[model samples]
Target: MNSIWVITKRELSSFFDSLTAYILLTVFLGLSGFFTWLYGSDIFFIGQATLQPFFSIAMWTLFFFIPALTMRMLAEEKRSGTIELLLTKSVNDWQVILGKFSACLALIAIALLLTLPYYITLSFIGPVDHGAVWTGYFGMLLMSMAYISIGLFASSITNNQIVAFLLALFVSVFFLIIFDVLAGNFTGSMGQFFNFLSISTHYESISRGVIDSKDLIYFLSISFFGLMLAETSLSKRNIVE
Candidate 1:
């Protein structure tokens, strides 16, 4: 646990010490704010008291932005031959993965927190569904966890940051688009199955201000599965070393 926190703090500090964190936060906030307030689907045009527009924009923005943020977590370490040095510090694979994951999540949480003014402004203009807004944030957090895990796994599999980014984007696209489309085209059990597998499906369910156990389970399960794969990949690298 201490090792994990040490790595987490180090990674988090490194993020702030470099331009990576700033770029990610700026782009994420800029796009999310633009689409939520200035774009065609702006809240004023929607005539709703909900943060649905922002949520919609956020979902798309995260799809691209998150991979960029996570692309170098392990890929760069491996490329620069620093992963071995990292491991030499009494840190196990799972601890390293968890530390990196926590750092990314913390960064994301900070980004999300910066958007609170949106909520505050929305509340002043109209009746905002506080419950829904809370749940929506929860859903986004879950979505981030899932993406971060997948992104970490992508990084673990390659020593090239660009390849890791592309692979993460490729993997995320399946959950973001392919599964959703397949779910729509299927029928009965097939539809149900695909829908169950779709991240958006669970996200929507939670965003409705209703926290379903199944939805929670789905997000956690996907995150866990991805992390386990990453751990396995790192273990293999250790064996090869």
Candidate 2:
């Protein structure tokens, strides 16, 4: 537990020291704000007292940004041969993985927190669907967790950050887009299966203020599976060395 917190803080400090955190926060806020207030189907255009536009735009923005954020979590460590040094310490593989995951998730949560002004502004504009807005934020966090784990897994399998970034994006695309498309093209059990595999399905469900157990399970399953894979990969590497 203390080990995990140490790694989390170390990773976070590195993010800030390198200016990655600032850049990510700026870009995320810029893009989300642009589409939510100034671009097509913006709040003014829809005239709705909801942050759906922001949520929708954020879904896509985070989809890309998360890979970039996580690309170096383990890949750079492996590339620089620091992973072995760290693993030789008191912490185990799972602690390291969890710490990196927590750091990335915390950064994302901060990004989302900065957007609270959007919710506050909506409240002033009209009657906002407070329940739906909160749920939407919750859904974003879950979705981010799933992707962060996937990204960490990708980072673990290779020592190249670019390869990790691309791999993570490729795997995430299946859950974010491909499965949704396949679900639309199929029917019966096939469609149902694809729908169940689609992250969008669960995210949309939660964003609509319907927090089903199944939705929670879908995100958790993906996150846990990805983290397990990452831990396994790291363990194998340690054994090889």
Candidate 3:
């Protein structure tokens, strides 16, 4: 537990020290804010006390942003041979993976929290559906957890940050779009299976204030699977060395 927290703090400090956190926060806030308040299908245009626009834009934004944040988490460590050094310490592969995962999730959570003013402002406009708004935020966090784990897995397999970034994006595309498209093209049990794999399907369900156990299980399963893969990759590399 202490080891995981130590690595988590170390990773978070690196993000801030490198200005990655600042840049990501600025761009995420800027893009989401623009589409939600000033650009197409904005809040004023809808004239409703709802953050659906923000939630909608954030889903796409996070899909791309998370990979960037996680690309260097392990890739750079391996590239610099720092991963071996860290592993020689008291922590094991799972702790290392979980630490980086927690760091990335914490950064994403901070970015989302910064958007709370959108909800606060909406409340002043009219009677806001507080339930839906909070659920949407919850959905975003769940989605981020899934992607961060995927990104970490991608990073773990390579020493190149760009390769990790692209790999993560490629894998995410299946969950984000390809599965959804496949689900549409098929029928019966096959269609149901593809639809069940679609991140959007579950995300939409949760964002609509329908927090089912299945949706919770889906996100948690992805997070666990991806992190396990990352740990496995790290372990194999260690064995090879």
Candidate 4:
């Protein structure tokens, strides 16, 4: 088998083999659904078709869920020492990193798609801007991928899944919320840096139908930096051993 596909198959199988995958999907969707109905009042409050509430809620949900899902990616393998077995195989570091990344990316894509009924419901009940809805969803996916990549790197660093989860959660929370919050505390160009550094700011901006190339690059760059860091960790495992 090709190295990339081999690693991908391994990751996909692990996700499905565990009940947590189903649990995550159910919890994420169910929680988001409940919040949507509760907050949006099922669109009664807005009285128009808008997914702002949905994305607003989902941003919070993904913050926690991504860590939970990604905590075990490499951390558990290191815990069991099976990472050595995989390293002995034909796969290169990129293949391993990309494969693990692709599997989580696929999972996020599936979970995002499952929320389509909400969009359909909005479209049915009122005049909804489907373009904006789709754009928001796309922005959410891109942002989620970046978050997941951070979690993946965290997982790669340790043999303890809890540590990985906390590390990933901290990083995500910083980028997702703290950076934006700091914008208020900083001044001028420095504050602008925080706003630019704020994943939430960029994500919400793009989610609101203003998709900029810079925003896309921000998302992609974080994702790349994370994967590269994971590979770097894997490379250093020998020294630590």
Candidate 5:
């Protein structure tokens, strides 16, 4: 098999073999649907319907959920002594990383697809901006990539899944609303820095209606930085083992 497909198959199979995929889809769909319909009002304009209710709720939900999905990506491999075995195979560090990342992204994409009913409902109740909704979906995809990368990094740092989960959650959440969360306590440059660091700032800009290039760059950078950190940590592990 080719590199991408090789990782894709492994990750996809892993999700089905365990109950993780089912649990994530159910929880995400149920919660997001509730918030959108109960809170946003189907008939009323919901600021793109995909923004305030769908994308906004997704931000908070992904903060806790993505880590759970990814905490075991590498942590479990190491804890099981499988990391060493896998390393000895033809796959290099990046192949392993890409495979795992691709798998997680596929699962996330599936979860996003399951949320389509919300859009159908919006169409039924009133006219919705198809462009904005599409953009919001793109923003969610970017956020997923960024979160999964960070979660993978956290998992790489240790063999404990719970530790991996919490670490990823904290990092993702901090950046998710870093500025808004810290803004109230400080002012001026400090506040400016916090705002600059917040993931929400970039995500919100994209979710509004347009696919801004700068926002795309920020997500890609964070995702790259995250995966790079994970690869570095694994390299250290290889040397020690």
Candidate 6:
């Protein structure tokens, strides 16, 4: 517990010490805000008194940014041989994974926090669907968690941050795009199964303000599977060296 918090704090401090956190936050907030207000399918274009545009943009923003954020979790540590030192501490493999995962989530949370003004502005302008807004944020957070876990797993399997980033993005693409495309191409039960596998489907479902147990299960299953793979990778490395 305490060990996990220590690692979390360490990772957070490291993020701020470098320019990673600031850059990611700025890019995330900027892109999201821009698309939500100015350029793309913005609120003015939608004219629905909903935060759906922001939510849609956020989902895409996280697809790229979360991978970049998690690319260094273990990949950089292993590259610099700090992972060996890290393993020698009182912390266990899961704690390290959880710590890193929590740090990434915290950073995403901060970025999300910065977008609160979007909601506030929407409320001031017109009638806003509070339920949808809440669920939209929840959906994005869950989607981000799944991506973060996948990114951490990708980071664990490689020693290069670039490789980790690409691998994470590759794996995430299946859930984000490929599966959805494949799902549409298929028919009957097969199409239904593929649609079930797509993260976008579940995200869209939850973003509409309906929280289903199946959606929760879907996100949790991916997150848990990714974290388990990461823990396995770390444990193997620890055993080898």
* Candidate 6: segments with Cα more than 4 A from true spot: 238-241
Model 1, span 92-192: residue lDDT tens: 89999999999999999999999999999999989999999999999999999999999999999999999999999999999888988998999999988
Backbone clashes under 3 angstroms, per model: 0, 0, 0, 0, 0, 0
Native-vs-model 3 lDDT?
A: 0.95
Encode model 3's per-residue lDDT on 64-131: one tens digit a residue: 99999999999999999998899999999999999999999999999999999988888988999889
Best by TM-score: 2
Candidate 1, residue 194: lDDT: 86
Stronger candidate by lDDT (3 vs 5) = 3
lDDT of each: 0.91, 0.96, 0.95, 0.87, 0.84, 0.93
The weakest ten consecutive residues by lDDT in model 1 span: 232-241
**TM-score (C-alpha, index-matched) for candidate 1:** 0.97
Which candidate ranks first by lDDT, i.e. highest?
2
114-148 per-residue lDDT for model 2 (tens digits)? 99999999899999888999999999999999999
lDDT (10s digit) by residue, model 4, range 12-115: 77788988779889999998988787754545676667888888888899889988888988899889988888888887777888888888878888899999
Judging by TM-score, tell me the better candidate of 3 and 5: 3
User: Order the candidates by lDDT, highest first — what do you get?
Assistant: 2, 3, 6, 1, 4, 5
Q: Evaluate residue 145 in candidate 5 and report its C-alpha lDDT on the 0 to 100 scale.
A: 94
Q: Decide which is better by TM-score, 2 or 6.
A: 2
How much does candidate 4 score in TM-score? Answer: 0.95
* Candidate 1 vs candidate 2, lDDT winner: 2
Candidate 4 local Cα displacement, residue 77, angstroms: 0.8
